[model samples]
Target chain A: MPDTPAIEVRGVTRLFESRKGFLFREHTRTEALRGVDLAVRSGSIYGLLGPNGAGKTTLVKILSTLLLPTSGSARVLGHDVVEDSEWLRPRIGLVLGGERGLYNRVSARDNLRYFADLYGIPGGEREARIAAVLERVDLLAAADRRVEEFSRGMKQKLHIARGILHRPEVLFLDEPTIGLDPKSARETRKLVRSLVSDGVTILLTTHYMFEAEELCPEIAVLSKGRIVAHDTVAGLRQLVGGDRTLEAEAYGFDDREVDAVRRLPGVSKVVSEEYGPRTRLTLRLRSLQTSPDDVAAALPGHSELSVRERRTSLEDVYLDLVEEEAH
Target chain B: MTTVEVPRISRSRATSASLRLSFLMFMADPQWLIPSMIAPVVFGLVAFELFRGSGPYYLTYAILGAGMMSMWGQTLYGSGWAIGQDREFGTLEPTVQSPTPYVYVVLGRVLWNVISGLIGGGIVYLVVLAAAGSPPAVPDPVGFVVLFVFVMLTLASVGILFSAAWVYTRYSGFIQNVGEFAFYVGTGCMFPVVLLPFWTNPIALIFPPTWALDALRYLAIPGYVGFGWGFWPDIAGAVATTAIYVAIASTVFKRVELHVLSKGDLSDY
Candidate 1:
């Protein structure tokens, strides 16, 4: 059972029904999750990445037993989240997006203590448990201060403190470092790594690709309620697939010129992205035989002023995959 | 540092903690506490002076009325904001997800309001005595104490029932306001329901708090004549009706909680 995935989600679909008008209303259905299936390995930091409205939070909520899936199953620590929510709740902790999840009127210490009690942390151990988590999140000094008086990052730290206060077997963190300063973000990531090392399974959702790459060994990228890519950092990077991409930032880059570049024998794909007045042309090449010089020459023919090559990155691949899903 | 085996939450401990925390929140916030406490008492004292020469029992009525309104206001605010404040703070979902029973937590939250009503009502009693220049005669001292206790319980039950209904509806904050107003006028807390049309008396009779106020007037005040009924009959109605209300509220609270868990979120109020 220890080797079993900490979280096992199968065919989880949550369809929302919202009425359009007050009267003479028609029900509009929005599929927040369309049969999402995922399994987060024990002791691993699993990154769930996606753009806004990609159902990342929906999945997190479902797994945490905060929202029941309209259809399908989600389990945490081998207990069904719906049927055994009470049993599962004690073993898992969740830090939902933003600072919406804390008692702003209470001190950070009280918030942590309150959540600790909610998790059923033994009374005898609560004080130290609270202190440990606060220390871990670098919030011990401000522990007695009211959370509303704290900065966004400090509140986030308090959120983290609450999440980890019970020493849960599984943790759901939806963009935990979203509003944090870089230094605090880095510290939080360090705390996350420590938690994983201590055998805690973490499910993290973030817009930061590099942070995901740095923290998560395995990631599942969601797009419009489905997983578009689920693999290791290198494996996902390979979705770009041996094709060398040369990005050119140009002033007059247009479709006609992009087509001209695509016509080049070695050019496999040409993607022109608008950047206000300028356009960044990404040339996906099958071989080194595809010359940037030839591509620039082809582009300059259509009034594009200067052209230079830029390396392909994970951000580029993530955007490309999301774009592909959008179409 | 070495970590010990994590322990399961103690329900008693959690409940006690939750109770203490909410009570602190109730007392600490000066903005709400000051206005809610002072406004009614001061207003009632001023009104009592004007009604002194005209209404024979206005002195006793003013004190009891102010106390009753404060109880209604505090109870409404207590039950009204329990879940809405959580959602506003974004703690509702997490709260539902927590291993502790939501009922225990909710009851803990409302516990402060019940205590507040008792203390506030007592304070109003003393203040009215000071303003009236004499303590009102208690016809039945033991009966009065017993009746007052029942009134507090009745008010608490009604507040809880209101909260249970509140969670199921989309109108959260508005529910409390409307409820407080209805209870104030309908319960005969201000003016006697006998002054209202005979039909409205039936509506007021539907609630135990109305019976509580009627019973209190008969048990405590010397000159108070209550609906031509004996104090025991009125007390019986208050106890029986409040029991029914509490049972209904408990059932409704469970249903509403399930809906909240499945559908997610409650009204904004």
Candidate 2:
């Protein structure tokens, strides 16, 4: 039981149907999720990285029991998401962060009170629990303020506050730090870390690569309704071909020059892109055997040639995986 | 690391909390009451003017008609509107995601609407009494009060069933609005079902409010010939129809919940 994954998804797919036209209806079906499989360990933060419309929100909604998958199955803490939603609901906290999904007219405290009751938080501890979550989210000062008057950041904080008010065993955060200032976003990331320390398994969806690299021990890259890659930051960097990236730029690179650079020792992949008149070849290396000098040596006789080497980042890994999936 | 023990969901607690939340929302913006009151007051004045010279018991008919109309607006339209607000507020998903069943939440709103509908009914009573210059003569005042409350229960049952439509679609409010006057005419809110075409009576009888309102009229108006079946059968019909509505509401709410989940459109509005 201890080794069992906190969240397990297997070949899960979701399709959305829409009808257009008034008199003669034309039905269209969209595959929001496509045979997605994933596993998140307990007491850990797992990051889901994807471009827009990559089915991150759809996956989160399905895991949170707000939507059902059309095929396959997903389970949280050993309970099937579809069949055991009611049993799982109280134990799972969901924060689909945005400007909406809050009672704008009522005080933040009142909104929490309403949800606390809905979650069946004991009457004896309801107020204290609300106060604790507000304090945890740093909204204690604005607890009595109407949500309509709160800033976007404050509303997001309240959304988190509501999510964790019940102290769920698992929490699903869909872009929790979106639209937040640096300081607020850092605070939210810190809050997420703290929740994990408290033994909450978190499946976090974020567009920020740095945030994912910093918080999640394991990350999954989703593209076009499918999981292209799932690994730790280092594992992802390795999967995308290496830990180091070398950039070589010149006015033009012939096929022979490009092939020579691609054949260099430790060079796993070489991607070329055109910027106006110059072509930039980005080489991913698995080992440090290939250096800037080596790259420059491989493509000689070019006065405009410039070679540089740096560590491959999570951003590079994410882009590589997403682009590969797109192709 | 505070651990939250999963608490058992109490349907009664959820319903009561929903009722309290609705009350708080209403208090925050009391202007909503003005629009809800307008229809009832207009109906009361119009009915009293038409019934003033008809007969001695005509005042009772007018008051009953207006009162039932007022409760219908509150218990039915108001309950459905609460759900529509949930959709617009983006709260429907979280509320549905909670451990509490959606029916309990709707029941809470219906309960609040029933209370407000009574207030609307009381307002109509005062407005009609003022217009006619005297209260309707009643042989059994206690029975009238009891029957009025029962009529609201019938309306509450129908309201519960109607609120499901709001959950089933974002366009439900428009559908309800278009059907509003039809419901009034069908249920014979401003007149007895018998006064309409004989063919319409069977259709009207399906609505619990029709049977309940007819019984209320029988108790309030002497020589009232509703169904020509007297008081007991009217009460029986109201009870049977109300039970059916409640049963259908339970099943329909479950299906609506599933439909929204399968469609994944709880927040589409």
Candidate 3:
């Protein structure tokens, strides 16, 4: 890999104006990105881990030249995002997650072909490039199927095909696995790994910490428009220590109990996920001194609650940083 | 896998490629072709039947008016309404983000709409010809064809302009539908603009499509056929108006591009 960065962002900020209220009412301003600075080395998979509203997509948009930053600047392949956008655009590919960006009526191959032409792929080489990408994404068998007929996973694979069709040096994937089945998400990660191994730089954003841990060499944790922590997957896990964690499973849990657990002393973070009829809460305590008893005492319905000490995953690291601001 | 060099398309090639994709996208849903053909002929039939006793002029007038309506449909629905559809399809963000200038894609989209308008116009002419029992001949086919081409181009430019300007409103369908119907009646596509109340003539005259429709009448309608000032002015006015609208469209597109990029929301990205 080259020492020079494939993607560089310096002090980028984007402010969105809310268009609410009548003619005389003032428009409100919301800061989507606040002076974020990041850099990704060439031929590396860089993951941005954040919950929704963390400005991960905002930063991705600015770097992809889809949205312009209100202040500061971002550059891709050494071209200024705002100034050299026209020149820089062809050099990068983007997969904005969960949107029906492809023409549903057209076959997957045709969709890739159309984007191929737009990217300046000559007619002679376009077929090969399109097919290569489809094969890489494991969508070769369904290449001629209309995009609308494809499942969510298939559509995502097609998007991956389109992104890599031009052989871009950098690929921007925002929440690439948000709605995919496990097998599809696993396949996508494999494709991403292959692309990076081929010396293509990838910038990925996702709420799935394990996906980040599995696929990305480095992960940046963004919370409410700022980067709170950035490090390698294992290094991030060590921030809260893998051993000092508490897991609680409760029956018939609701938001009120979750909020109540969040306010308990020594509790630094809280992440809740529903499994079947029960809710699993992962809480990161302030220190090793904090105990499972402290958590059990805070439980709303103790009769049906179970608490245990466990090792921390990447999710614990993310929740620790983001919920720090929430508390 | 062997790595290949990043692709690069020339600016002209980009525009043409965009045109090809958008047209293919239209054809991909072949059902769309039906309404384009049906709307004009249906309108022509109703209008022609209403004026059956008037003379042969009724058939020529109904066919011409319906043809213009189809062209306007191309501008309104194909160009303007398509913008809304693109947004709904979630394709707008990707297209805008592509290296190719979005204006070219929009230009290409309108161009195909112009082509669809021609198809609709042809169907209207044939249907009216069959019903009227004779084909209405243009006194000067060359002059009529020349004017018709310019009229289509001018209307196309106007559609491109509307596509750009309507990005801000987000409700492109409602806006373009209102514009299409208003201009159809206002431009005298179904009747003579001069016959409209004294107040609407100036409003109708400002539209390039209105002037083009008048030029078409001068070329095809036997009683109105001529090479005089009455005839040449509409051609000149349509061409000049088209040029001005084209310039405005390009400038507005640049501004909107900047605005959307800077202030765009998540959905836009």
Q: Residues A1-327, candidate 3, lDDT per residue (tens digit)?
A: 356688888888888887766878877888988878898987789999888898988898888888889899798887899998887787788998575888898889888877776778888887888888888899999999888899998998888888888878889999988799999998888888888888888999998888998998898888888887888976776666443568899765677787877787666667788899888988866556567887787675558789999777787788777877577
Ordering by lDDT: 2, 3, 1
lDDT of 1 by residue, B117-236 (tens): 666677777777888888765667687777777787787777777776656665677767666677788888766666778889989988888888898888667766767786778888
Model 1 chain B worst lDDT window (10 residues)? B1-10
List candidate 3 stretches off by more than 4 Å. A23-26, A241-310, B1-6, B28-34, B223-228, B266-269
Lowest lDDT 10-residue stretch of candidate 2 chain B: B1-10
Going through the candidates in order, what is chain B's TM-score? 0.85, 0.95, 0.89
| TM-scores of the candidates in the order shown | 0.89, 0.96, 0.86
In model 1, the Cα lDDT at residue B136 comes to: 65
* DockQ scores of all models, one per candidate: 0.46, 0.60, 0.43
Scored against the true structure, residue B1 in model 3 reaches a CA lDDT of 19
Cα lDDT tens digits for candidate 2, A209-325 = 999999999999999999999988999999999999999999989999999999989999999999999999999999989889988998999998898888999999998999998
All candidates: interface RMSD? 4.0, 2.6, 3.6
TM-score attained by chain A of model 2: 0.97
lDDT of 2 by residue, B1-269 (tens): 23347998889999999999898888777676674577778878988888878988988888887887778878888899999999999999889988999999999999999998888888888899898788889989999999889988998999899999999999978988998888888887888888999999889999999998888888888888878998999999999999999999999998989999999889978
Candidate of highest TM-score:
2
For candidate 3 chain B, which ten residues in a row score worst on lDDT? B1-10
Clashing pairs in 1: A100-B90, A120-B8, A120-B9, B172-B269, B173-B269
For model 3, state the Cα shift of residue B82 in Å: 1.3
Candidate 1 off by > 4 Å = A20-26, A248-268, A274-279, A285-312, B1-12, B50-59, B191-198, B222-229, B266-269
